[model samples]
Target: MSASHPDNAPAATAASAQAFQTRLADRAAAMETTLTEIFNRRSAAPPRLLAAMRHAALGGGKRLRPFLTVETAALCGAEAATALPTAAAIELLHCYSLAHDDLPAMDDDDLRRGQPTVHKAFDEATAILAGDALLTLAFEVIADAGAHPSPDVRARLTLGLARAGGMTGMVGGQMLDLAAEGRWGAARLSPDDILHLQALKTGALLAFAVEAGGLVAGADADVQARLARYGKAVGGAFQIADDILDHEADAETLGKRAGKDAEKGKGTLVTALGLSGARAICDELIDGAIAALDCFGAEADMLRHAARFVGARRS
Candidate 1:
């Protein structure tokens, strides 16, 4: 059959999507193994804290952030194994965020990844300590000699992740979200305001995934910049998709509470723009994400697929 035949297009598209999913699953599984190894090596921590950390991080989830790190590094010509430490570091930080986010003082959710949240599974203080330990452990993983051969690279990765996880990024965004909920002061946020909040909260760490990948690969400035742009675009699209899911999906499907955004009066793109408008913006971000990858060749197709996947995902 002709490769260009119209009859083959649908089959080709399906095959491509399947291939992307397979690759995503493979990377996700690899990241799970990496996390396992990390825990195995650090077994001397307090038993309760270790149990809470393992419970909070180990069970299930897509592991999207780590996959991004591995893939971005591969695109820059680094091996998957070489990216594992940095990737694991990012996942540790993400798990820490989730543990803390579900604390009584925060979102107070009872479930995560379809299981009891850390606080519920353990105790409030243990959960807090677990979160704290996981957060510090992220830097520990990234700073290891395994992450990179050079001190310069290690330092950059450490500094970059710190900024991404700190007040200038995710923490700052969380503060703004609380204000949206009237914890400090309530105010109606415009679309731009929502974007800013999401950019800081959700997008910063995501963007750093690729930035870390580039740093790991020792890619030049132009490549790093392009990866950063793609990461930011995908981060924006991912958050919008998440907001849409909260509006439409149930808790069972989301593996966590659905519609908490509404309950907390959190401002989102979906709230600022209507659902249809939010979808439009999501598509635009996906377009921008793909465009950012034009500098790379076929090696970046997986990334392009990731952007499309972000826009169309249901949960």
Candidate 2:
């Protein structure tokens, strides 16, 4: 890593990658533990539904959304522990979305995170209920006193999540996506339309994730704005990266059906702009995301690293 030894530049890069992965894994583990405890306190609920809920929420993945929340909170001078409840809440909401998205009426996916999806493992009704329960419990987690001592913080986080996942957010985007696909005699979407849908469907939650930390830390408006911008760019990059992977990666590598977007006639950045153009947009988003954090110093390095890592997702 010594600058004097330029010959080891590649080695240094590899070391840095390893360290970032290690850091990511550590944060993911912490979030997993919180989720485990939350799911464990449901003895009164029906056993099967609880199991299905657990299956949906506890399934293995990168846990990136919650990781961003915790990391952004840390960068804004909040303790990771203090931010964990909100982080876990966001993760639960994310899992709920995935579960519903994989339903026959939605994305109709059979696999998730390399495992049989909730509907396939259980039943469609169970999967639906699990997703519903997870979504409802997410609010409960965020509203709980444990999420933040200040009632105002909890309220703001709750409202933010509602707006992100509600009619004007993910739900609206899903509707737009279906319409764009001509499911009900809808028209074809232009590139701008696709971008707007993506911002609502995918970017909203991520924007909330990055901003959640600041809310937890009581960060000023300017810091919150920076995190919001960073989160938005990162979310854009993630979707584009995923679009590229869907075309390039196989089922085994992607943990789900590949090229489903194309098969379903979905309009994506890739479909609209082609592979090279989509990648260029992704690169620009990553650069902008990193630039958004320049207001901070070395403390924001992990976030900058995260922007690249998220964009780099592939087979």
Report lDDT per candidate. 0.88, 0.87
lDDT (tens digit, per residue) of candidate 2 on 158-184: 999999888788888888887777788
- Segments of candidate 1 deviating more than 4 angstroms: 1-12
Q: For residues 215-293, could you state the per-residue lDDT of candidate 1 as single tens digits?
A: 9999999998889899999899889999999999999998889999988889998888889899888877877887888
Query: What is the RMSD of candidate 1?
Result: 3.6
The residue-level lDDT of candidate 1 at 178 comes to 84
Give each prediction's root-mean-square deviation over alpha carbons. 3.6, 3.6
Candidate 2 wrongly placed segments (more than 4 Å): 1-12
- How far residue 224's Cα lies from its native spot in candidate 1, in Å, is 0.9
Worst 10 residues of 2 by lDDT: 1-10
